[model samples]
Target chain A: MEEREISKAVIKRLPRYYRYLGELMENGVERISSGELSSRMSVTASQIRQDLNNFGGFGQQGYGYNVKYLYEEIGKILGLDKKHNMIIIGGGNLGQALANYVDFEKRGFYIKGIFDVNPVLKGLSVRGIPIHMLDDLESFIRDEQIQIAALTLPKSKAEEMTALLVKYGIKAIWNFAHIDLDVPSDVLVENVHLSESLMQLSYNITRYEKEHPRS
Target chain B: MEEREISKAVIKRLPRYYRYLGELMENGVERISSGELSSRMSVTASQIRQDLNNFGGFGQQGYGYNVKYLYEEIGKILGLDKKHNMIIIGGGNLGQALANYVDFEKRGFYIKGIFDVNPVLKGLSVRGIPIHMLDDLESFIRDEQIQIAALTLPKSKAEEMTALLVKYGIKAIWNFAHIDLDVPSDVLVENVHLSESLMQLSYNITRYEKEHPRS
Candidate 1:
């Protein structure tokens, strides 16, 4: 498949589409129209068509889209068809949670190792993945060919850890740390700022309260 | 201050702005120009100016923006100045991690209680907050006047729990379940799909590998 530069907006929504389609497939739905899929997704029908068109629209004019085919295709587009070896940088609560998140394994992301600074947690394991100390990180990344590293470390340690990860030739980082990382342009970062999300929710709640003042 | 409808795009950037301003304040930066802030944030100067402009443009023509003032204003806009009481609907690893995350309390969203279906987990405390059984959920929510609920339950229980939460008057939901919840229009839901994030990472890795295929 010829890959053109898809907009970040479209790329962001692909995962949701992939998920909705998977749900449809699980419910035994064979095919669905753009209108139907859009309603299920709460996205506009035209927007769905346009977004799908970016990756060569797989819809038949009269028949709509094949649910199974669309699901598989979108999976391939999201690069979930291949296995990815990843490691968590801090084996704290968040790191352990990510390591134990069964969905990652289901989607082809294998937790090869977990690294933490704490010596007490060094020998511990989460979901059969051993937690290794920061000292062993360099050789482990090289030997295991770790493709991604999740930073669940403190903000103070984030930069140093990022530098170490980048030095060890890590490709992508799923950072949960409070600070924004300074990495090479080649390294992709997807930050999961829980506080930021909480702030957004707070904003929404405030808006709702103001708009619907109690009697 | 009068409130007007702010664009979702601009609202989305507010958190980043808030964080950057916070970092600046911590670094003893009392003021910053749009260009300076833009360089720090990686957002365009014009874009930063425009986004802040939505909240009365807390900037001077040449003197630049008062970082402390802007930070406080953005914090107020995000409703971070107010306290919010919340509960976790599932006491799994993800739920425990969220409970252990101290940043939420600093942001004024307090985790008052954690509810779980598992008898083994019930009565266990995470960071001093006790994990209660599903039976105590209703009374706890009502008694505490809980404003937010974080759903960390499995997909099978997500819908049912959402129904219960809606019935008991949960204002907002931070859903970590794989399912897209069906809640009332008044109830807000922010989904954190771990698999979707991994998929995005996978897509980026694929793009990077394609763009810079190792020799």
Candidate 2:
């Protein structure tokens, strides 16, 4: 299928499908019907079928989908089949927490190093990855062939650091910074605004309470 | 406006509008036309107008929108106007990281305490909020009136802890437990699948590299 034919909304949902399938695979499930999968996911069965059909129909009419095969297929589609060298650009709480997260490595994102401007964090290591000075970022990325840089820096420093990462040939950014970055068209950015999600929770709580007021 | 008239898609976009308007207000911009705001955000002007119209039509024919007023209005709509006491149910790396995060407080979700089954973390504090044993969770929630619970626990423990939180009367759950939760209709669960976002980044990078092959 042509890339242009796929909608951005569909692209966003691909990861979710991949995750649910992964869970099923881990549970030793062999196959799943669209209806069953839809029951587990927030999406509808027809929508699930439509989404899977877009990339060439993986589901058989009656046989459903082979869990392992479908999981592998989605992983390949998401480029999780190959290991990508990544670095955290901040050695603060979020950065440190992400470095210690074992799931990233399990999903083929290898953290080569972490970089921070603070001299106090220079020698610290999280999960065996040393925290290096920001001054060493360029040389480190070059030497390590780092493909992704996770920006957990402050909003004040986000844009400047993003420019530096782009300049140093980083291909993508997983930005946790509170500011929107201005990257070149070629660079891939996935901004993870924590507060936005919290706000969504806030909205949900308010709506739920209003609808189901205590008797 | 009736609550039923507001779609979930519109509810989700409120935070982005709030964030953008907050930025504009910070820049001392008093007002903005939909066209200008649309350029800054990626949304279309018509869609932005429609979304705002869903919530009592904040825009005017010639005046566009008042930036500060719009920001505050969106904030109130998302229930960010009132402070909500919250607790982190795990004192692991992620929980510690979130506890240290100051942005939650700025958004009016106060981290009242952090709880963990591990005794080693019992007395530790992140950003002045002390970590307590899991045994203290019930009493802590009762004493503090924690409206939201952030679950940063492992997938193996998520369901058990979720049941406990529900039993303890948690109104909302900001879940990072890497598992789908089973909550009653009255409870709000916002699942933050970190790996899914990472996979999206991986896919975007792969797609970009494939399309823009190096010369």
Candidate 3:
């Protein structure tokens, strides 16, 4: 339980850290201290220690950390060691773009199929992944052993498809739709409310200005 | 200065609270307490109080909080006042869907234009917003006063567009392109790494199971 809360914050930052670590590992850096990591990442050293403490004190007081070991540990914490088979719902620009996306695949998720209600899009191949009609969603998820679902559908259709995913036994959903969904208390849904994010960024500009105070 | 760090956390959670409050507002909820808000939100009450304390203590001793006032205050804090002009880059399914979205306008965000390098997509109306060529991005952003930009471009192009936006004096970009962007330190580039979010959900399921000891 002590580890879980810290992991939440750590998990959010892991992707950014991974990109940096990947560069370091690629460059053959073999060790890093919390101080070194903090300096490189522009965060406080204590923050690095606290975040790492949640996953057991993996760093020694003076010995620093093995870059390879820490990178692997972060990968394990982020569940990047395991490949996640995913399905995209919508088969539109977002869906097609995801199907062809090299980034997710590099990051440990693979899109196996795209689903849409439109028959015209069905049987179409986007970046090598087949587009199936809505009815095939259940079978594709089950047969492909798809573990995650990406909801890029419209708000009107999002809830309906979410229910279908839950009914079909999908464990998690990355919802791109702009609606709040009421799932069973256990289902994990991250609603990517794009507008709200924009609002936050706009507010951040104000927040940053307030903090820095121009000199 | 006393509230800076606390405010960042509170500010992020404000949108979540707003969504929850939006539901209650529709349900005609007139008043709520910190305890009630905590229970409904699955968060700690002390955390709620501390967050609220980032600003002046607005919650009365026993009378709780007036829902309407809180909602309006959060909206203002989040910079959700009036409409925010936005441009959708890439004109793919996700971009078109964003342009086609009616909810953004309802949420005080206006989709001003859609841009694509494709000639076929140009000169067309995406959800009534004119789809322009990528070449016109600078003129369009300046003329329309667009501060918010959503990138649905392929990963390779995401970073390029982000720098372009910074060049055009755009302060914030909601990146949907799934790439880590290098922008000027001053620009607020919010990269919603979809893959990382999905990984978090997957990892959370494992953590949730362990904590609950599900049979």
**Reference contacts recovered by each candidate, as fractions?**
0.71, 0.81, 0.58
Clashes of 3: 2
Candidate order by lDDT, decreasing, is 1, 2, 3
Q: List, residue by residue over B1-215, the lDDT tens digit for candidate 1.
A: 75788999999999999999988998999999999999988889999999988888889999999999999999999999999999998887788889998888877889999998889987789999999998888889999989999988888889988999999989899988898888889999887887877788889988888889889
Candidate 2 C-alpha lDDT tens digits along A40-145: 9978999999998878878999999998888888788889999999999988878888898798898899999999989998898998999999889899999999
**Cα TM-score per model:** 0.97, 0.95, 0.82
What ranges in model 3 sit over 4 Å off? Answer: A1-7, A26-40, A53-69, A155-160, A179-186, A208-215, B1-5, B28-39, B44-50, B57-64, B158-160, B177-185, B206-215
lDDT of 3 by residue, B20-89 (tens): 7787798999999989988888889888878777767668989887888888877776767756788888
Candidate 1 i-RMS (Å)? 1.1
Task: Report how far off residue B166 is in candidate 1 (Å).
Answer: 0.9
Off by more than 4 A, model 1: none
Residue pairs in clash, model 1: none
Clashing pairs for predicted structure model 2, backbone only? none
Clashes of each: 0, 0, 2
Which is better, 2 or 3, measured by DockQ? 2
lDDT of 1 by residue, A28-77 (tens): 99999999988888899999999999999999999999999999999988
